[model samples]
Structures are given as C-alpha cells and as structure tokens.
Target: MSTAQLQYQSQSVAKPYFIAAIGLFVGQVLFGLIMGLQYVWGDFLFPEIPFNVARMVHTNLLIVWLLFGFMGAAYYLVPEEAERELHSPKLALALFWIFLTAGVLTIIGYLAVPYATLAKITGNDILPTMGREFLEQPTITKIGIVIVALGFLYNIGLTVLSGRKTVINVVLLTGLVGLAVMFLFSFYNPENLVLDKYFWWWVVHLWVEGVWELILGAILAFVLIKTTGVDREVIDKWLYVIIAAALITGIIGTGHHYYWIGTPSYWQWLGGIFSALEPIPFFMMTIFAFNMVFKRRKQHPNKATVLWAMGTGVMAFLGAGVWGFMHTLAPVNYYTHGTQITAAHGHMAFYGAYAMIVLTIISYAMPKLRGIGTAMNDRAQIVEMWSFWLMTVAMVFITLFLTAAGVLQVWLQRYQPNPMPFMAAQDQVAIFYWFRELSGVVFTLGLLLYILSFFIKGKQPAAQPTAA
Candidate 1:
C-alpha cells in the first residue's frame, strides 16, 4: 500500500466516532427542547417523559457525545502529530463500537425503565453509583466506560509514546488520563451528602473546569496550527500558558462548588478568588485563536472550520469567562446558585468551551476523513456557517432569557423582603421559560441544518493528497 493509503487507513478510525457524536448531539438537543417546554407547560410530557427523565437524558447525552467527540479528535490528530500511523487501528475501532453500544444501551435503559427499576436491574444496588447528576449512568454502564477508556488510552498512549512527541498530543493525553481518573470518584458515593458532593465535583467541575480545558486548549491549538499555518512553536507556547492557567485556577476553583456544600469557611474565600481567576485561561484562548488566525501564512479552504475556531474562542470567553465570573463570587452565587442563572452559565459554558470545540474539530477533520478535500463545497460551507450563527444566536438568546428568569426567580424566591413560595416563583418566571423554549426551537433548526450540511452535495473539490 502507498503512504497515502496507509494514512487514510489510520485516520479512517475517526469517521464513525464523529458520525456518532453528531447523531447523539441531535438527540441531546431534542431532549433539551422537551425539557425547556416542560419548564413552562409543567406537564408537557408528564409521566411519558417527565421533566427529570428528560433532564437526565439531555445532560447524559451531552456528556456521552462530547466524549465521543474527544475520542474521535484524539484518533484523528494523534497519529499525524506523532508522525506515524496509529499503534493499533483495530483496537480503536473495537473500542468505538463498545463505547457506542454501552452509551446507547444506557440511554435506552434510562428511557425504558423507572430510575429505581433501572438501578435494580443494572445492579446499582450492589455498587450504588447511580442517581448523581451527570453521573447517573448505571454501575454496569460506568464499569463499561472505565474499560472502554482504558482500552482507548492504551491505544492512543502507545501510539504517542512510539512516535514523535508534540505538546498537543502530550497535553491531550494528560487531560484524557485525568478525565478517566476523576471519573472513578463516581463510585465513591458516601452516605454523607457533603462528602458525596465534594467528590462529585472531582468528576464534574474538574472535568469541565480543570483537565477538560487542557483537552480544549490542545484541540484548539491543533486546529489553529493546521488552519492558520502557524508555527507549532508559537502555538505550543500559547498551549502551555493556557494549560497552566487552566489547571492552577480550575483545580482550586473546585472550591466554588464547595462554598455552600458543608465545606469549611475558608473555601468561601479560596474558591471565590481562584474561580474568579479561572477566566484568564479562557480569555487567553480567545487571544490565542485570533492571533494565530490573523498571522496565518495561507488561507485554508475550510472557512467553516476557521469560523468555528474563532467562534469557539470568543464564545468560550463570553460564556465560560465572562458569564462564569458573573457567578463565581460566593456572595453573588449565594443568590444565583441553582437558579436559571446557573442554567444560563452551564448552557453557554458547555456550548462555548466543549461543544463548539468538538464541532470545530469535526468541521476541520470530517471533510478530509470523507475524502472531500480540506472542506465542504462552497454551498455546504455557507449552510454550515448559517447553522453556526443560528445555533450561536439561539444559545445567546436562551442564556439571556434564562438569566432574566433567574434574576426574577432570585428576587421572588430569595431577594424579596418576603419571599414567595418556590412554585409561585416558578410561575412568575413562566414567560422567560416560554422565550427560552422558543430559542430552543431555533437551536434545533440550526442543528438540523448542520446535519443537513453533511449530506448536501455540490461541485466537488479535488481531494488533498494525503501523506504517510
């Protein structure tokens, strides 16, 4: 086989993963719309698909799909960065099927059975790892995840160790390892709520705010380097700075979640100060992306990828940095915690930082994976860009509407001289929920267009020659 064919065979492992991620993404957004409507209608899907069930599915789908994206990204980029084919393409493909099967079965179990029944059937009674938000996967499913992750890391790790080492693959591997390690805490549920919650942040806050940012930075840096023709040295420098800042702040920033969760008082100040600094890395990422793009040596034909790259920077800053800082301080968070404001931050931060980064990688890699040149045709690019703006604008509106609802919820439920009842407060915020649901509709449309762009045909560009 020629060098080009060998490279294609190596990278081809990523195509199914990307496809699965996008497919799951659509499911997540659909469930999100269902949950949004439930906020106002109160019984929109009721027993058939209760608000809690919809929420669990929505959140779980988000995590699962993003994991797929991350894995797909690693598979797509690691070999190239290492200057070799994968250590074991067969292992990567096998793990993909295993992970996907486990994920799909878990989701089916959630929707098909009652929570308690699912727990019983899945042997959660023996392990007791279910019931936590985002960690709601059954004990069996969690075990499957761990096994899949181990196999995955072994495959990627061997490839990276055997080939040339770059800062990108190294940092990415570090993050993936941390992700798997932190997830072990899900099985550490204690009878003490305080302890349970504390360790839970190890899995949740640490993943998103901590190591996952490492993954985000590495992926963004790789995309920027490819799209902008920037020197790896320059991008590597930014990656180091961003990763250091993200870890320094994000690890300690876990304190922010500790403030009211029966932790020590010192956490109030420690969490507040450190979490406040968390935005620095995201802000740095924004500058890093634009600077690299502005300094590009050549214009890559993948305009949609570049757009997603730039958008990831700006939006991650706005969502994760600015909006997150909006609530990181203990005093402000005291009022905003658990309110729609929290939802606003969660929605945008996840979208801006993780979801967009994943999509950015897919945008950059999918064309090449499909042998369709470095990008989609002009018409598809236009459609994809339209999807980008539509989804982004819709998300902004969703966040804003949720923020409005949150503020009102705070005032009526917490800030007022005489607080209203919880359900009463929810009733008062119904209008904002209506608006949020509408924004969700727009988001769904954007997602559909995004999916459509994949299939839309146009004049084909010459496939770029691949290398070994």
Candidate 2:
C-alpha cells in the first residue's frame, strides 16, 4: 500500500466509521419514506405503525444518522486537527459498535413496543406511553444511550483535548460537546409532562437550532472552502455570520413553544421575535454556497456534490427556517401547533439544510477516503445532484401545499366559531389534504432516487472506505 493508504489502514479513521455512517444513512432513507408515505395516504401503510410510532422513527432516524455521520467526521477530523495519530483505533471501533447497537435497538423498541405498549408490557397504567414514547425507553435502553454517548464523548473529547485546536476544530468540538450535553436531556423521566417538554426542547430544539447547527454550518463551510479552494478567510467569515445569526435567534426562539403550554407570557414574545430571525442564517447559507462557487479558485470536477451541498444549505434555511418563522409567532402559532404546516417546515428544513450538509460532507470525504488522485465519476455526481434538486423542490411543493391546508384548518378552527359547525370547515379543507397527498408522492420519488445513489457505483476507484 502507498504511504497514505498504509497510514489510513493503521489509523482509527481507516475503518469502521464509514460502515456505521452508511448504516445510519440506510436507516434514515427508510424512515423518510415511511414518514412521507404516511403523510400522503394517512392510513395506507402505517395503520399498523401508528402516527407517533412513525414519528419516533422519522425523528430518531435523523438523530442517529447525523450522530453517526458526525462520529465518522470526528474520527476523520480529530486526528487531522490534532496533527497526530489517534489515541486509540480499538476504542473508536468499540464506540462504533456501542453507539450503533444502542441506536438500532432504540428504533426497534420504538417499532415493537411504542409507549402504548408500556401498560401491557410492564403492567403499569398511570404512565401514558403511547403519546410520548420516551416513557417506554426501558431503564436499559436509556442507560444504553447514555453509555453510547459517554463512550463517543470520551473518545472524541480525548482526541480534541490532546490535539491542536483550530477555529474549525473548536467549532466541531463545541458541537460534539453540545451533543453530549443534549443527550443528557433524554435521560430524565418522561412522567413529568411539563418538565419532559422542557427537557425535550433542550435535547431536540437546542441541539438543532443552537449548538449542532453552528457545528453543521461551520463544518459545511470548511468543506466548501477546502474543496473549492476558496480563501479560508472568506469561508470562515461566512461561518461566523451564519452561526452568530442562528444561535442568537435560535436560543431565544425556544419561546415559540411556550405559547400553548402553561408558561409565562414572556415566552410568546421571546420565541416569536427571535424565531423570526431563524431564517437569516439559512438565507446566509444560500448566499455563502453560491458566492463560494461563483468565486472558486479552481473548478472542482465533482460538480454534483457541490451543487447538492449548496442546495441543501439554501433550502434548509428557506424551507425550515424562513417558512417556519412565518407562522411561529405566538399570535399565529396558537392555532397551528401540531398541524401539517409545522410538519412541512420540519421536513424541508431538516432534509434541505441539516441532512444535506451531512451528505455533502460524505460526498467530500468519499473520494478522499478512497485515495483517488482526482475527482470521482462525474456522471454519478450529476445524477445525485439532480436527485437533490428534485427531492428538495418536490418537498417544498409538498410543504407549500400542506401549509395552505394547515392555514385553512387553523382559520376554520379559530375564527369560524366553534358551534358554527365542524362539517362546514371540514368540507372546505378536504381538498387541501388531497393536494398535500399528491405532492408527497412526488417527494417520495425523489427520496427513492437519493437512496439508490448509495448502491450505484461511482466512477471513482471501488475500494472500501476508511471509517474515520
């Protein structure tokens, strides 16, 4: 083997991490399909699965995939950042198995025993399991997740503390730290409903909106600049811009959730005002990608991945961040909470912004890990890029349709007067749901093609990927 290949083979980054990431990817695509279909046909495939059950699948899959992908990236990055070999390849491998096992088992439990099963499984009735499945995490599963997080944190944290810390490394480390802290939220007992929501927001919302997003935006900008040969100074500048905007706005944005719950009146004011700026970072991301591409020092042969990354950054901000802002106001969101519009915002934002960024990282590293001298097969990149656009645009359409439906539903429920009649409102909004279902079908096709890309061989050398 060549020097680089030999070094790669002996290193922690050399194996296992990629396999874990790919597994998460497969699980994620399946979850997306399940969630998408459920939205369209409502009762078609998921009658057996239940809505909340499908929800846990969808949301948890995203968390797992992103977590695994981040682990893979950290494995790759930590050593590079430290300017030395990893502390322990064996430990890295151990973490892969531990985390992978924990993630997979958690999802399986979700499928087989959703919270509703708690009463039957454990002979307990006072605890409501079906609505909030976290209640069902069995002490074992909760402990397992904690163990996995600790193992990962120990491995990554050691590498960072012992190694050099660049601006990029600092940002990445911050994200991992945030991830570790956030997992702590999942540890609490769900029986405390109000407290559970508070903790849930801490784990789910804070990680995505605040810390990890900064990590995502930071890492994504790093890849774009590195690959495109843009000035690091410019790229880093953009990173500062996006993270600053996302955090300041996102942290306070938590207030939006306070509207319905038994909370102080200030949350309404806080959440609405800050969340309105949530899209600013997303908007900045779109500009960052396009601007970098336009001014690239040299054209990268892998046009498709570049396009997809940029597309994801832009769309995530617009679909998830911007549109989410529109109705998030306490005044507006009061009626639309738990509705399809929220679903629409979540789908586009996550897939477009967060999911795409991780995929972009995968695309960037694939050729590097394989040790191919130049670009991989351009054809696949182009095809994958097309799939990216198709899926995003299609999803946007679906969200738009759903948003229309949700607005109609909200207006009918809130304004038309309760006794004015359920039948009248139901009759008016029936067609919107039909439109959402139709849009969902198109979105599903796009996702299928995305999943297919993984199996299709690219033009690059066909060797196993290094996990780091």
Candidate 3:
C-alpha cells in the first residue's frame, strides 16, 4: 500500500487518544441501550445495573470520550496549525494513559460499588462533590481530572503560543481553556439547591452551548479549508461571526436554565429572549458548510470526511437549533421541563454538534495517521459513510420517539385538569420507550460498523521497479 508522509512526527501521539475515544464511545452507547431497555422493561437490568447506575455510566462515558476526542483533535491539529512539533509529545502520551486509567477506574467504581458506599470510601464526605447528575465522579477522581486537564492545557498552550498564531488555533485554545475553567464549578457544590443547580449549568450549559461551539466552529473551519479548498480568510470571517453569535447568546442563555430554579422572575424574560436567539450561530454554521462545499475549488478524494462535515452542520442546526427552540422559552419549557422533550434535544444536540465534530476530525486525520494516504480506500469510505447514515438516522428516530412521549407526558400529567400519577403517565408512553429502544439497537449496529471500517483493508499498490 502507498503511504503518505506525515507533516509532523509528534502528531502520532494522537493515535492512542483517538483509539481510546472510540472505545469509550462504544461503552457509552452500550450503556445507553441498557438504559433504554430499563425504561420500558422496568426490571431489565434488575439488581445488577439499575437505571440510575446505567444513566450515570452513560452520561459519564459520553463526557469522558468526548474529552478524549477533543484532546486528540488538539494534539493532531495544534502542531500543524502552529507550524511546529508538539511542545511535549511525551507529556501528551503520559496524560492519555493517566486519563484513560482514571476514567476506567471511575466507571468501575460506579458499577462495582453502590453509590453511597463508593462516596464514603472515596472521601466524598470530606469534599462532598459526589451524587450530582453528570458530576458523579468521586472527588478524588475529579481532582485527578483537574490535574490531567492542567497538564494538557499547559502542553497545548505552550505549543500554540510558540508557533504561528492562526485564528483556528487561537479559537480552539480559548475554548479548551474555558472548558477547564468551567469544570471547576463541579467542585463548588453548595448547600443551596438553587445555587448548586445554577453553577451546574456553568459546566453543562456553558460547555455545550458556549465554549464548545468555538471548538466546533474552529474544527469545521479547518476541515472546510482543507477539503473545500476554500481560502482561510473566507473561513475565518465565518468563524468569527459564528463564535460571536454563539457567545453572545449562549452566556445569556444560561438564564433559560434559571427560570424555575428559584431564580428571579426577570429571568423569564431574559432567558426567553436570549435563548430564542441561540439558534442563529448554528443556522449560520449550516449555511457556511453548504456555501463552502458549493464553492469548492477542488474535488477532495475523501468523500467520507466531506459528508461528515456537512452532516455535522445540518444535524447540529436541526438538533440544537430547531429542537432547542421548540422548548427553550420559559413558558414552553415550564411544560416540558425534565420530560422526554429535554431528552430529545440532548440526544441529537450532543451527537450532531460534539460527537460528529469529533468523528469528523478522526475521519479526516485517521488515514493520515495510519500512513494510508489522504483518505481511506473506497471500500472503507463506503462502509464509513454507511455507518454515518445509520447512526444519524437512528438518532433522529430516537429523538422523535422521545418527543412523542414527552408530548403525551406533558398532556397527561401537567396540562390535563385531572392529572395522572407519574408512573401512570409513564405507562401511557411505554410504546414510545419501546420504539426508542429499537432505534438505540440500530445505533449500536452503526457504531459497530464504524469500528469495523477501521479494520477493513484497502487494495494494495503494486511495487515500483527496483533500482539497477
């Protein structure tokens, strides 16, 4: 097989991080399936893996794997964008193992030990940072994460500062730094429920809706410049517009979460207006993607990467922009709060915006990393494209099914004059849960195919004649 020369040797360190991200992504999806089953079957996992445990694992794995993907992306692109080798490839590799081990041990602790016992043993009482939804990692594990994050930021930060300063590198570095800072809120769990929930959004809402958009825009711009052959100036302008809109709306959009959480009544107006405007950046991203592709200067051989890039734009708009708008208004959200409606938005938003961007980078960079060429062979590309459609379509149906269930839940439990009990309303929506489970099964199959594509061999090139 023909191999292309890698631009930088230190970029090779990203391979393990990407590999770990994919592996943990598989774990996340499996736990998702388990939780989906438990929703309808009630006792499916029984004593072994209860719904709460499955949910904790599912959400935690999603966070951990996405972090891996982000780190891998930074390692891969920062060196090239900076026009130099990584500042510390050795540190990058060391952090990868540290993160992987800490993540695995944390997950095991969740599964093997009960939450209360695990908390006690892990010294949560001393710090009391355990048991919050999505922030369930033991205090010790959280500290480990902080250490790893600081080391990672130090490595990437130095590399970017020393090299050529490009918009892409600067934006990515800014987002990463914000990510680390926002995570500190998880440790500041106050006794007041309102305050705890308030700051929780700093890490959750701000990461996904705020700084992560910067990361997403930067990655998309880089891919567009490469695949579409668009000039960096054109892409940089679009990126600036998108991230500006994202920050303006996203920071104020934090009020949307404050509406019912014992916050002031003014939040109803502030959150409603700002959150409604939150879709603008995502919509611009969709337009930017198609505009660049339509104006492409060259036909890139890596059709699969291009497809993922386009899908990220469209799906993100539909998921984060459209669906989010459906229930973001305080009045509307009052009815849908904590219902399956929220689940609908989360399912697609995370997959389309964060997960797809991560996979897009991997798709574009993996072939180069493996010395296989600019892209995978036609066969592998075809399989990968298939996996993309399968997973994407499955997630759509999952969101639809959940939305249907949420509508019924709101009507039966909240809107009606005579509301049913929570369990009773759940019984009315069992069919949708069953449908969601089926969609989850298809999604898992797609993920399996995606992993399989990595192993599929392409045709070998004939050898050149030996020198006399």
- C-alpha TM-score for every candidate: 0.97, 0.86, 0.97
Candidate 2: minimum summed lDDT over ten consecutive residues — where? 1-10
Ranking of all candidate structures by their lDDT, best first = 3, 1, 2
Candidate 1 residue pairs in backbone clash: none
Give lDDT tens digits, candidate 1, residues 1-468: 222422546978988999999999999999999998888888897798988889999999999999999999999999989988898889999999999999999999889989889999888878898999999999999999999999999999998999889999999999999999999998999999999999999999999999899999999999999988889999999999999999999899999998899999899899999999999999999999999988888788788999999999999999999999998899999998998999999999999999999999999998888877777998999999999999999999999999999999999999999999999999998999999999999999999999999988998655343311
90-135: candidate 3 lDDT, tens digit per residue: 9999999999999999999999989999999998889999899899
- TM-score, candidate number 3: 0.97
**Pairs that collide, model 2:** 18-467, 115-129, 116-130, 256-271
For residues 1-468, what per-residue lDDT tens digits would candidate 2 score against the true structure?
A: 233532344244533566566566666656655665555456756557876777677677776777777777777766765666777778778777887777777677777765656435643443332334333454565566678777767776777788776667777778788877876766564665777776677766887788887778766876786657888778878888888888888988887877777778888888888888888888888888888887877666666668777877777877777778878888778777876678778777777767777777766666556655334565566657767777777777877877887677677766556623545665676776677656666666666676566556655634223211
Q: Stretches of candidate 1 above 4 Å error?
A: 1-8, 461-468
Q: Global CA lDDT of candidate 1, please?
A: 0.92
What CA root-mean-square deviation does each model show from the true structure?
2.6, 4.6, 3.5
* Residue 8 displacement in candidate 3 (angstroms): 0.7
